[model samples]
Target: MKIKVVFLLVVELLVVIVVVVVVVVVVVVITVAIAVAVVGVVAVVIAVCVLRVNFVIVKVELVIVVVVVVVVVVVVVVVVVLVLVLVVVVLVLVVLVREVTAEVGYSTGSSVLELVFVIVVVVVVLVVVVFTISFVVRLLVVAAVVVVVVVVVVVVVVVVVVVVVVKVVVAMMVVVVLAIVVVTIVVIVKVFVVIVVVLLVVIEGEQVVVVVIVAVVAMAVVVLLLVVVVVVVVVVVVVVVVVVVVVVVVAVVVTAVLVAVVIVGLVVPPAEQNF
Candidate 1:
């Protein structure tokens, strides 16, 4: 019985030792499981952080790409717009050239009409000048006729006076006195007619010169007016062309900038999301 009891006690001690070992093994396994869980949680957290970082990086890259794309697109659009505008301007210039050519044709016709009108005016002026000169000549001739009549009357008066003097002097000395009186009357009549002809010729010549000067001034004024009209037409066309080209260029540049911005927005990452 004593041996049996000792054996029983030893058995109980072995059982207790086995239970302790089992408990220690269970505790170690639980600790290992908790450590594994913690490690997994940490790994998941790290993965999430890494993924968030990557996502942010991607978003930033997308934003950058969008901006770059927008810029590129805008530049291309601007270039295209500029080219279109250039083409339009070139077309406009071509049209302007055509219009100018047409205008030139019209102007040529107008110039021809003006030339005809000037010719008519010149012919009329020439006719007027001729008429004026003829009228002046006629007046001068009339004046010459009057002067001739006056000279004849003066000669008649002088002859009558000489005759009376001769009658009175005849009683004193007859032949020499009568011959001197006749020679003096003839000389005075010739001198008076010559003086009147010379004065009339000089006045008519001066009037002709004045008429020619006035005609020349009128022609010069007509020519000046035509020149001014031509200059104004050319200036207006040039100014219109310049303004059109400037407007087209400005529109193209603005359009290209807008296109580039849009393209960049589509390609690049957003600024707020970028690291």
Candidate 2:
């Protein structure tokens, strides 16, 4: 009985050891499977995060591109509008000039002489203006020319009329002097003495000096008027030259700018396609 009991205890110890070994092996396998599942879940989460970040970056870049396109379109439209406005203004000015010229050229049928005079005056004024340095200088020169011309013309006419009227007086004086010369020799001598005395008094007196001074002053006034006219003409000419130079330079620069704009406009993609 003692031996049988000992054998039974040994058998029970072996079965317990085998069962514990089996249970330990099952627990290790289950832990390994759980670790693999956790690793897979972590990998999936990281991949999702990376993909989401890339998607966000792409969306932001797209938005930025869209905003830039919108701004460029707006700028192009504004530039085009401004250029059109400038063209219209230039056209209007050209038309107005043509119309005014036409109207002046065709205005009246009966006043041909008057029209010719007017045309001549206008041409003279334009010539003077074109020669001047600035608009203000041109105006001043034109005014001075008109005033001087009128004054000179009036003075010349007056002098001519005065000379004509004095011709008879000068002829009578000559005849009287000749008659006195033919009269009595003593009477001629006395008359000659009296004339000499009177002539000496008038020529040597302050009155004669005053008359000379007045004549010199009148001549100086005329000379001064002439000088002013010449100076005005010179200034007008210089101004016109300067204006022409400036206009040429401005026209060249504007033409270059226009050409550049045209090139850019043609080369650039259309507004809708630029985006």
lDDT of 2 at 83: 33
Angstrom error of the Cα, residue 139, model 1: value is 79
Candidate 2 yields a Cα-based lDDT of: 0.34
Candidate 1 per-residue lDDT, tens place, 199-263, comes to 34546556765555554565465446534543553454345334433443443354345434433
List CA RMSD, all candidates: 64.7, 55.8
- Of the candidates shown, which would achieve the greatest TM-score relative to the real structure? 1
List model 2 lDDT by residue over 1-275, tens digit each.
33333333233223323322332232223222322322332222223223333355344333433433343344334433433443354344334434543544421111322232233333323322232123223223322332333222222322332332233222322322322222222222332333333444556655765655554565465446535543553454345334433443443354445444434444565573342
Q: For model 2, where is the 10-residue window of minimal lDDT?
A: 106-115
lDDT of each: 0.34, 0.34
TM-score of 1: 0.24
